[model samples]
Target: MICGVKQPILLVLVHSAPENFEKRKAIRETWGQDQEGVKLLFMLGIANESEVEKTLEEENVQYKDFVQGNFIDTYHNLTYKHVMVLKYAVYHCPEAKFLLKVDDDVFVNMPNLKIFMKLFMAQNSERKKILCSRMCGNPVLREGRWGVEISEYPESMYPNHCSGFAILYPHDTIFALYSEAQKTKYFWIDDVHVSGTLAKKLCVTHIGLEELILSDDEVVEIVDSSFINNTKPFLFGRMNLDVHQIRILWDFVSKYTPKKVILDYLNY
Candidate 1:
C-alpha cells in the first residue's frame, strides 16, 4: 500500500509520466497540497532508463506519495496504470468516499470540485456514479497517433466514455469496475476500457457530457478575474500548460476576488 494518507474522503490519483518532475512539483506546491479530508498521490509506471529510475526513487523518498506500477510508462499502457490505481485503492483505501482520476497536465479546482461533490451527493444521495465529460460518435482511428487494430476493438464507433483526462468515481463504482476489469479483455485505450466498456459491463452509473465541466474555452479564460469569480469548474483539461502557466493560473484561482467584494465594502 502507498503510504502518507489514511481514510481520506477524497483520493486524487494523478496519472503522471516518470520524467515530469517539474510538472509534479508545480502541482504539489499549488492545488495538490495536502488538505483536510483529501489525499493526493501521483501514479506512475516503471521508468526504462536508470537515471529516470534514480530520480523517481529520490522523489518518492522526499514526497512518499508516488505509486509506481510494474508496467512500462507509455501512452498505450495507460490502461495498466489505471488498473494499478484501482487495485491500490481497493486494497488500501476502501473507506474513501470518492476517487478522482486526473492526468498530470490537468488543473483541478479543488474548491470547486468540493462544492460540486457536495451538491451532487445532496441531489443523488444513494446513487453510485462516475462523473466526467462524455465523448461519443468518434470513429476509431485506423492509422497514426491514436490508431487501434481491428482485433483490439471491432466497433467502428466508440461507446459513450468519459474523457480520460479527468474522471470522478464513487468508491463502490471503482471497486466494481476494478473487479470487472480483472475478467475483461484488455484494451489499450484507458478511458474506453475502464470507464466505458468495464463500466457498462458492471452496470455503474455514468454521468457524462455537459454534466462534467471540462472546457478548453473556459480554461483559456481562467486567468480572467471575472471568470474566476463567476465560474466553478470541477477540472480543466487540454491544458498543455508549462510550469509558469500552472503557477499563474493557480495564483489567479486561489486569490480571486469577486467584483462585488469592493462594492459591498463601499456600501457598508
Candidate 2:
C-alpha cells in the first residue's frame, strides 16, 4: 500500500512474528497508534503454516497494516525480514521523514519519543545519524539459537552498532542502509548485521541514547509509581514486558498526555 498519504512525519515499522497477534494488538492500542503525522505498520515474513497464514490474513483484512515478506517466518531469517522492511520503506514510504524499527516486545514511550524527535529535528547536524542505544564491541555468541559460528562471522567482537531492541533512523539513512544491505552478505543476527556490520561498512554515525534505553530499575519505577507520578522518563527499553504491563502503561500514560497532535514537546 502507498504511504505518505497524510504526509507522514514518522513511520514506525514493527518487526513482528505472524503468530504474535496479541502483542501486535497491544502495540496498536498503546504507543503504536497512528496519528496525523505518525504512521505504524507491521513487517513480517510469510508463515508456512496454513492456519497461521489464514489468521494473519484475517488480521490484515481488518487492519490493512501488514507488509509481509516472501521468506518463511523463522528466527534464522530475521535478516531477510529486516532487509525486506527497509526495502519496503524506501520504495513505498519515501515521503516519510523518519523510520522507527522496533521489535514487538519493546515498550515505546511515544510522548517521550515525540519530545526527543522534536529536539532531534531542530539539530540538523544530528539528523543524518542513527539515533539509538549504541552497542560497541559486543561479543559474538557461539552457542544456542543466537550462536554465531566462526565460519559465519570470524570476528570476536561485533562492530559498533545500534541494538535492534529499537532504532530510530532518519529517512535518508534508511535509503542508504537499504542500498548497502543489498550488496552485503546475509548475517542471521539481524541486529548486528543491519545496524552493526552494514552500518560500519557505510561508516554511519550513531547518536548514543544509552540513558534513554530503560533498564530493570527504570522498569520497576513504572510499577512502583503505580503508573502515575513519574511520567514516562525512558524510551523503547522495556525488557520483554507482558501484554498486561503494556496496557497498564498505556492506560496511565494516556491519562497524562493529551490525545491531540503534539505541537509542544515540553508540555507533554
Candidate achieving the largest lDDT: 2
Q: Clashes in model 1: which pairs?
A: 134-209
Error of 2 at 218 (Å): 2.5
Q: After superposition, how far is residue 261 of candidate 1 from its true place, in Å?
A: 18
**Tens-digit per-residue lDDT, 65-143, candidate 1:** 8989988899899999998888888987787778889888877767666656666665666556787777767789989
Q: Per-model C-alpha lDDT, please?
A: 0.77, 0.79
Report the C-alpha displacement of residue 244, candidate 1, in angstroms.
Answer: 2.1
lDDT of 2 by residue, 133-174 (tens): 777778888998788899999989899887787888887789
- Per-model TM-score versus the true fold: 0.88, 0.90
- The window of 10 residues in a row where model 1 has the poorest summed lDDT is 259-268
Top-TM-score structure, candidate number = 2
* Candidate 1, superposed: residue stretches over 4 Å from native: 1-7, 209-214, 224-234, 257-268
Q: Model 2: clashing residue pairs?
A: none
